[model samples]
Target: EEAGEHVLEVEVSLPELAELLGEELRLPAIRPRGREAVLSDVRRYRSIRRTGPESLRHFRRTFRTALRRQIAEGTYEPDRPVVVPRREDRRYRSWRIAEVPQSNAAVIYMMDVSGSMGTEQKEIVRIEAFWIDTWLRSQYRNIEVRYIVHDAAAREVDRHSFFHLRESGGTKISSAYELCSRIVEERYSPMEWNVYPFHFSDGDNWSGGDTRTCMELLREKLLPRVNVFCYGQVKSAYGSGQFKVDLDDELGDDGRVLTSEIPDREGILPSIRTFLGTGR
Candidate 1:
């Protein structure tokens, strides 16, 4: 009662944050597609043996064995029913250790660094990316993340540069898609890896030709290989906001392709659900 230090320390783990995101957004657990390349050792107790530790003793089998022994020896009586298991009658469980397939994932994050995408838009992308990574990490045993940013052209960068690097130029959304396709082809094989590509942009493209190129890349190269292709259109004051509309009109019928319009930071959760709720 004398000590007045009443401070409580709170630490939120990545798994806990992932659980919160799933609960709030009603997200479905992702079902990995394609061959699971990773293997994990799993032990299953399926057979009974004669000797083992007491922890693994099979009581029913031991009693049955004792009763059979007594009956054979003519020591078991109907009036006075009792069963005592001898040391030789003890039964135990035996386990079979096997290698089972485990699913692994690769997440490729793409963002537009054009002049139109402002600080607020990047911040929204950063926050959304963090939550999405948290949820995906919880789902898969091994996960790899790659970052690509584009203005007039696209280039791969580290996590720090992906979010903070500033670029002032015209936007070409197709460049990022091309880079993503290359990365997927070289590193992540469709038969072995569950690939997820998430792209954030202001929905401002330099030309309709580039938009067409993006759609072509997605349909021919990206969509066929990935588990899901998610496009998040972060709102910007100078953005034309036409790319999402085009994606809706073109790829809406494909379940592997998803697009969400993030008007502001408040829309992050719903967008996440839209991207992941299908369990693909």
Candidate 2:
């Protein structure tokens, strides 16, 4: 019984768990034929399987032993059944410990949780952020993630509340930017940390003047101190969708400012790739 339990444990660790996920849902790096690609090729597909090829190597050896035993025992009648497995029949993949470059990255996630931003939008942000965290963690030895949820005012919150809190205050984009700048100044020094500020919103603002203040903060305070500032405008029936256009018109040529649109949950993956693909 003990030996049976050990075998069960070993089987549980196989890559078959990941393989069982449909091709579309599986992480890009572990997909069939994906092993040939370098980490740089799919940095945005951030899910990392904890069990590498080394884990599977043990199973391959065990399978070979089992096959040989079955053949010797005459459980496999080669002549009558026409069963054959040559020395070349055995295939075991080798895994090399990839030397992933160590870079410090700080991602500041700011979300608008005003009346216009609904639970569906928040869920989308939550899912995308999880994948982003996974990918960045794989690449960097040290990663710091800061969450700021904003309405007319903004405050730093823990990871749990960042994705779950529901509030109905008015929208003011600058408050979030200001809070994000303070977090950077206090915790993440730009000299040592590759800062990435990503803000998710429905493009609703309290006023045109507040939008101008947001631009000012990005240009004067945020952009200069970070590697990249990303803004994802989530589409909403109540939103005007003006903030993204404003930022694009103002900072279209600025490499530091990257922007994307998340129309729904389906767009989350591509948006994550767009934001992090630069390795900035």
Top model number, lDDT: 1
Query: Which window of ten consecutive residues has the lowest lDDT sum in model 1?
Result: 1-10
Error of 1 at 92 (Å): 32
The residue-by-residue lDDT of candidate 2 on 91-141, one tens digit each, is: 444443554545577889999988888889989898878767766565555
Stretches off by above 4 angstroms in model 1 are 1-8, 37-101
Per-model clash counts, in order, read 0, 0
- Cα lDDT, all candidates: 0.87, 0.73
Q: Spell out the clash pairs found in candidate 1.
A: none
Model 2 lDDT on a 0 to 1 scale: 0.73
Best by TM-score: 1
TM-score of each: 0.75, 0.70
lDDT (tens digit, per residue) of candidate 1 on 127-210: 999998999987777899999999999999999999998899999989999999999999999888999999999889989998
Candidate 2, residue 150: CA error in Å?
0.4
Candidate 1 residue-wise lDDT at 202: 84
Error of 2 at 51 (Å): 16
